[model samples]
Target: MADTTQDYTPGSHPDLPPPSSEVGVIGWLRHNLFATPLDWALTILAVYLIYVLVVPALDWMLFSADWAGETRDDCSREGACWVFARVWSKVFIYGRYPVEELWRVNLTFIIQFVGLAALMIPGVPYKKWTGIFLLIPYPIIAFFLLYGGAFGLEPVETSLWGGLMVTLVIAEVGIVASLPIGIVLALGRRSKMPIIRAICVAFIELWRGVPLITVLFMASVMFPLFMPEGVNFDKLLRALIGVAMFSAAYMAEVVRGGLQAIPKGQYEAAQALGLSYPKVMTFIVLPQALKLVIPGIVNTFIGLFKDTTLVLIIGLFDLLGVVQLAATNPDWLGFAVEGYVVAAVGFWIFCFAMSRYSMYMERKLETGHKR
Candidate 1:
């Protein structure tokens, strides 16, 4: 009955050694990159290729690139003209928007950023109120501020809006509007009611079957013809509607995939607990379904964001459109590569940030071990 448990000493195990770079870095490299002579050779080859590609790209971007000098002549023929992208930054951001009225756009972005930050915080009190402000009142206020038909503010036409402002607006509005619309469509598609299910199926199929360009074209040309005489719609409004509808169709399919992934047992369990169909769906199925499909939803959003540039084909001057327009300027001749590179970099940053967020959300919500 005396102490039978052996006193264990630290570092007593002979099988395991204290961790070091060899077991960590070297071990990983050996297994992943240089386990065999062929792997080592391939790894060396890859390094050589990266260096070969990156050095020239870096030289073109920085070492030999023009950082200053107003005229195109100041730019080195051997490297990029970064100064062009710098000087046209405002044009990229605001498109054709009047410089004097840029305060309106700035204010709208400030409000939106602040509101979204507050909403994302789990500890925020009065979330319902915050949602009301962000969803309802904020849009109305932003609209008046942007359009400026009231309170002695000069009215700015939608045609005047361009650049990153229009791109972001189209993306944001399309994503926000599509989510609920998609949810409804998904639910309807899954419903027991024959009429509801059939209607949802047809609607989803019709929209999904058509390419987005066709939808945009229809919105720009055909929508006007369908409208009553003297009932005019803003071009931006038409594009926004088109983007939203096209996105909603894709989102509906993504959400339905998530919904379909939910187990039958889960539905049965919810129903057995005296829950109606709505309660079961809302409280049990949907939360899990949406969580499961966060990546899909984000991918859809990123695609929609990138596709906002397509509106330029219909006369809207989104960020890419502005760049194209700038290329035509006599003063800024022959700088298309600089403009396209900057635009591509801008897009890559936004899309990369979104992909990182999706990964973070997936990790944060993970409930089980991944194999």
Candidate 2:
């Protein structure tokens, strides 16, 4: 007897045509840019805007640009004067950080890169513990490296630290220090105890309600009054405290949102399993909550990074501060556009890369919630 069952092939569909050549670039454009009248209109508008902005930029940055030679005087062209940039590149990157001690900053960058790379790798066992260790000791190591008061190295004051180096230090320290403090605040805000919740709420609200500049001012000027008569805090330390406190307030709100998003079922289930509140939070709820809000956390970090530039307002030299300083230099005068453009590009690249990484992490950690 012959079998009458229909046959199934694992491969291609016989009824469908082979993939079309137009389905790549042309198809993508058609679908995304010309799918409907509205899309087409938007695409045209975007193209026009791009042309309006980019054409002139290209002309200034490349076509009529002066890339070679020394001094602004050499470039008599109508394009961007990058000669000024070339002359003051070190000042923009390192500020007044001594030329001889530049190696220390470079070494700090190397260590930070290595540590971050290690933390990012998923295959590393005990990753959480490793991250904790990196987080805890990094400030101390970075401080010693940058300040250089120990190990027979000459003492470098915070006032001398400027440029991107200061920006990175402030941002990194703020984010790291704020995280745990934020976590505690978030927990307190949701705590059963009225006093704890009230205190947390007040702290978060007070900090968030005020502008960061005012906080920085307080840190720089008012903090000295609060200190003991003979002792004085470093300007950088004061700025760090201001940034950390401001960041913690915002971070607390972000973490609280994460906590609210977590299902009550998870909390009850953890309790049902005879686990303590801390254990439940650490082992079950917080992991899920944090994963859910990773993007928000990264956004906060990006904001903090950008805000670190504001230290210039309180007389602390950061990346933007250094750029402003270079722009006003008598030797390289009348090059504000070049200096600002460089700083803006640097900031854009850093923030853009961080935003992209956050998106990647979100996708990498996404798990289907289908029941």
Candidate 3:
């Protein structure tokens, strides 16, 4: 060392430090969950709560469950009687939809799915018109399939329709039908003509002010009074009308927000370019407005989907109604939990996927605007 070797000094090297025992998983747990007495207590309580919930669920649903059987009687254990679900699944999904005509529903589903997928694809030519066609013809084809008197197919009354299938059909139709109606109402509300604005405001406020159940009641009972005699509509159609009208009012407000969000300069610029009002709106304004309100539109749709459950209250056998029916069956008694779980899972999956897609579209359209 005296000859030229440098003396080693602690903390002299910037990169060197004492080894830390407080930087790994143990350290993280200690800092986050056990750093203080209160933190440790809360963490233990949360763990116990989770265990209480999760363990029982796992035991009933998996460990002690009976899944394969022809009847609820086959399930002899003190656990989830999933055999009820297994036996009655078809009825739950299709209601009394005639085993032979099940394929029609499947076909409609395929067509709708393909159409929606096409609509979602980027850079597709004539996408707007394609979407419009998809939205318009869906109800017609679905109607024919579900309520078949055409092409020699037996007419299946809407009263017999139920399960997830009906829920989807109602939700889709409500969303599709409401969009144009809502857009028009929104535009009318913002129109320069005082009469048009007043009319639009009156319609929107009248609808938005009332509960959906009351509107549904009016549709079921009062709507026929308004219509000429011998021009009867199906109960399902009446429900659809109620849902669409109610949704349109809310959607109009949403679209109005989007319209207001667009800069006034855009309108002036479109006018300066000699674009007529309709062209300015269709090409320049509505697209931007709709893009801004995609989330709201999706939310409206989710609400409509959930509201379809209300059809049960009106004696329509939709998904919830069918589940309730199944629950009340003497053969499948005490399976309310299972039936509701199935319905809830189905609704959750649909609403969750739609909400996620709306968020994605918001980001995507934002990118388009930036470009």
Candidate 4:
């Protein structure tokens, strides 16, 4: 044993730092951006493109942009006239909702903000109750607050509801209303009953086949012709219904895809345990299916949010629509670009938030199942 036998053991030696060219920012750049000739070329090309396009855009948007001003006359034509956005900010948010009763709108926004914060933020207690409050009573409260014919409040017409307020209302209603409808459709599509399946398939296809704009148009126009003579639907109501139905069709397909991904063994196992169809679906299948389809569901929601802008065609001004309308004002003329930029930024923020939330949910769910 004492003979010249050298000890050789992995990890016995003190760990030395990795090479400078293989571990830090330079290493990352080398591995990811310059790993090969093609990567190097692409990295250089991307940088050049960004410099050519984004740098000047940033300069125009930030450094050169006019921020402090009261009117279009105060703006210099060399850069963006953000004063247009500033002057019309209230109009962009509250639209034609009377200035004297703006408190109701402000209150509704406050309540919603609190409710959403409770629901989304971690460690909030009694979340189920909070969710129920948001899902059921909050909508009624919001409607009354915004519409305000009840509770001795002044009545604001649906026509007065435009801008970000209307946009959010339509989007929230569509999102909340569509999910359950979509789930039912998806289940019906997969049902063993031929009649149910046929009806679901027909409904989904009918909505999905047509463009959303056409659906909105029909809801605003042709839909009322079939109704009773004295009964008239609010244009915003029609648009909301149309948007919900249209989104539900797409949502049904997404949910159905998730349903199909579940292994047959799981269903058989649930049945073996003496679970009924509804029980199995509620307790096991739907939970898994919905989790699997979070990305698709959120994608649908983002699209639906953006599609609220299309309601402008039906004469319901959403956020973008309001901005466009404000831009046309005689005093604010020639600032259409600034208004559009504001709307674009607003949309991007919402869409990006949704996307990030989707990613967070995915990571939280730890959906590691193999497809």
Candidate 5:
């Protein structure tokens, strides 16, 4: 040892850290953005395109935008006239709901928010009971709170219901009403009985084949003719029913695909445990299948939510419709862009939230299904 052998321990050379370029932000960029020549080129091109296109757009929308104004006269032609949106904010949110009675609409929204938060957040007590209340009775309470034909509350016609309020009402009702119907249809489509399967197939296809606009048109127009004499169906109610049925058709297909993806062994295993058909599906099959198809189901819901805009065709002014209505006003003649931007952002927020929730569910329910 005193002779020229270096003192060293086997497998120990002061374990070196990875190069800094292979570690943090630099590593991520190298691995993802500049992994190959093609990626490098694409990244550079994307940066260039964003600078060329998005930079000016952002400049117009933010830096030069007129945020402080009470009327269209305050807008300078050089940038976005956000004043139009602000002026018509009432119509955009609560629609023609009486200014004096805006409290009802606001209260309904508060209740909905509270109910949803209590249900969704973890560690809240009595979720099962809360869900039962929300499912069975909350709709009735919300309806009366908005419609107001009882409890000494002044009645607001469905005709007065427009803008984001109506938009959310339609979408929420359609989503809630459609899910169970779709599940039943999905089950029926896969049923052993021939007649039941055929019926489910026919119903799903019939609704799926028709465009949503046509469905809304028929619901608001032709449906009245078929009703009995002296029987008046609320226009909003008709639209709700049409939307739910149409969405249910697409949802059934989604659910069916999920059900099919399930391994046959799972079903056979449940059966072997002496479970009945309904019991097996309720306990095991549906839970797994729904978890797998969360994305698809949420996609359908997003589509339905956007399609709620089409109710404007039936003379119901949704968020978009209200904006369009405001744009036509002589006082706000040339600010359609601002109004449209508001509506677009509103829709994107709701749709994005739903999409994120779907992803969360997917992650929460993740099993050994991924590669």
Candidate 6:
């Protein structure tokens, strides 16, 4: 009978073995790029194609490009007209806004940058308060600053706002305003009340069914017809509202998907402890749902940002709009490539930053992997 009971203790290990050489950087390149004859052939062909395309472009843009020029005449046909970029950089960034008032844009951007960075950093304190300020007082302050009628600042019409400033405002407002509205709409769509469900469903479907460009056109053109004859709204403001509403519809769908992913037990458990619907959602359900749908939310955000370029159609001079205008200027004629390249780079940087941040948050919030 001695030692009949099995020893149940599992042994613990002190160290993780280093990954084999076959899994290191060199090994990774070998496995992914050059593992077999066909892989090697494809890799070589790809690299050769890349070099053929990239080297000449690099040479033209960098080594042979005009670095200093006074006018289009100074630019050589053989290389990139970099001088155009240098001269019009400010115009690209600030649009046709009065150069003297550029500091206001700078100030707004700096405040937004610092505030958003602080909020995004994991360990920063007072985030809830910061968010409150952003949603509440921040918009009022920004509106006055950007469209000043009081505080001794001369009023600048929304028509004067353009370039990166216009782009950022449209995008940021859409993002901040859409999230909470989307959540409410998502919850309403799932509500037990028939009227609430129908309204939410109709709202979401109506917006989502239409193209955003149509919404913008309506905001720019038809929206005025609906308003009182004397009363008016800023064109930019109208565009912002249109963009936010359109984005919220898509976001509601994303949020609804996340809400549905939540387990029935979560709802039942929340109810068993005497939690109300709002309490159950705010404390237990929403956090998990939002966490699950971060990728979709970020995708919507990126699409929303890119969609801001369409503001050009409505006569707003966003970054791309300004670039198009600048490319046709007498002094910078035929430099559409230069202007387009700069705009493409700017857009890529912003979109790439957002995508990377989403990935970081996803990894940070990951709870368990499905087997």
The models' CA-based lDDT, in order, is: 0.90, 0.88, 0.88, 0.92, 0.92, 0.89
Tens-digit lDDT string for candidate 2 (169-209): 89988998899999999999999999989999999999999
**Candidate 5 wrong stretches, greater than 4 Å:** 1-41, 369-371
Error in Å for residue 329 of model 6: 1.6
Q: What is candidate 6's lDDT per residue for 1-371, written digit by digit as tens?
A: 57765555567534566668577897899889989999999999999998999999898888888889777778877888888888888888887778777787787788778888888999999999887787798888887888888898778887887788888889999999899899999999999999999999999999999998999999988888999998788899899999999999999999999999999999999999999988999999999999999999999999999999999998999999999999988866789988898899888999999999999999999988433
- Predicted structure 5, TM vs. truth: 0.90
lDDT of 5 by residue, 1-371 (tens): 46875677887667679999898999999998999999999999999999999998898889889988897778886889787788889999989989999999999889888888888777898889888988989899998999998999999998998899999999999999889999999999999999999999999999999999999999988888989998899999999999999999999999999999999999999999999999999998999999889999999999999999999998898999999999898877888888889999999999999899888878877987867
Per-prediction tally of clashes: 0, 0, 0, 0, 0, 0
After the best TM-score superposition of candidate 4, give how far the Cα of residue 102 lies from its true spot, in angstroms: 1.6
Determine the C-alpha RMSD for candidate 4 after optimal superposition of all C-alphas.
Answer: 4.4
lDDT of 4 by residue, 175-275 (tens): 99999999999999999999999999999999999999999999989889978998998888988899999999999999999999988988999999999
Tens digits of per-residue lDDT for model 1 on 160-249? 888888988899899989999999999999999999999999999999999889999999999899999999999999999999989998
After superposition on all CA atoms, what RMSD does each candidate show versus the true structure? Answer: 5.9, 6.0, 3.1, 4.4, 3.4, 7.9
lDDT of 3 at 309: 93
Q: What TM-score against the true fold does each predicted structure earn? A: 0.88, 0.88, 0.91, 0.91, 0.90, 0.89
TM-score attained by model 2? 0.88
Could you tell me the lDDT of residue 119 within candidate 5?
82
lDDT, residue 212, candidate 1: 87
Local accuracy of candidate 3 as per-residue lDDT tens digits, 163-273: 888898888889888999999999999999999999999999999999889988998999889999888988988999999999999999999999999999999999999
Off by over 4 Å in 1: 1-32, 121-128, 369-371
- lDDT agreement of model 5 with the native: 0.92
